[model samples]
Target: MTLVRDIREDDAQDWRRLWAGYNDFYEASVPTEVTEYTWRRLLDPTSSLIGRIAEIDARVVGFSVSVLHDSSWTSSPICYLEDLFVDPSLRSGGVGRALIQDLVDLGRARGWSRLYWHTQANNQRARRLYDAFVEADDFVRYRLTL
Candidate 1:
């Protein structure tokens, strides 16, 4: 059974391992400074960033990081599920789905206006899991690094 819970201070090492795997999967080379900053923000009580851990039999198997933000389109806050990763060996074993469901349940309980996320078009495995929750919407995302 998978148990989903908030990230604790002692989870830093495991979280870092999973975080590196996540970056590798996306071919992202996030600098060390930024990673440390993100870690600090997640642990800051005043920050909107949140982190969650997924464990099975006391071993950390996956993790999710998100942020709550105000939206111009709604009165309540919205949650953007920024990062989610499971051990590659554990894919399709329900860990990912459980993480997402935990967020959905959290959003509802917190009265969030919406919960959303995006993934690469070619990620069919992830798409299949995501589609089980909701269909992909007709929106194109544009990013500009400044």
Candidate 2:
């Protein structure tokens, strides 16, 4: 059975491996220094970032990061799933689903009004899994680099 829990300081190596896999999946590169900074932030109590790791047989195989923010449209807070990644070898083993379900539970416990995430339009596998739980919105996203 797969288990999901909040990320701990001792799971640094496992977190790094998952982080690298996440970046590789998107064909993106992140500097080691930046990754270290992010890792520290995730573990910092003063930081808003919250992370959870999925483990099976004591081995971490996936992770998800979420952030809570106050929404202008709603008085309650919103939980935004910023990142989620599962090891390719462990796909379809319910790890991802467990992580997401955990996130949903967390949101509910915290009185969050909404929990949402986005992925590449062409990510068919992720989309398939996501569609099972929620419908895609009609809006398009645009980004402007500073």
Please write out the lDDT profile of model 2 over residues 61-112, one tens digit for every residue.
9999988788899999888999999999989878888999999998899889
43-106, model 1: which lDDT tens digit per residue?
A: 8988999899999999999999999999999999999999999999899999999999999999
Among these predicted structures, which one has the highest lDDT?
A: 1
Give the TM-scores of the predictions, in the order they appear: 0.98, 0.96
Candidate 2 ranges with C-alpha deviation above 4 Å: none
What range of 10 consecutive residues in model 2 has the weakest lDDT sum? 41-50
* Pairs of residues clashing in candidate 2: none
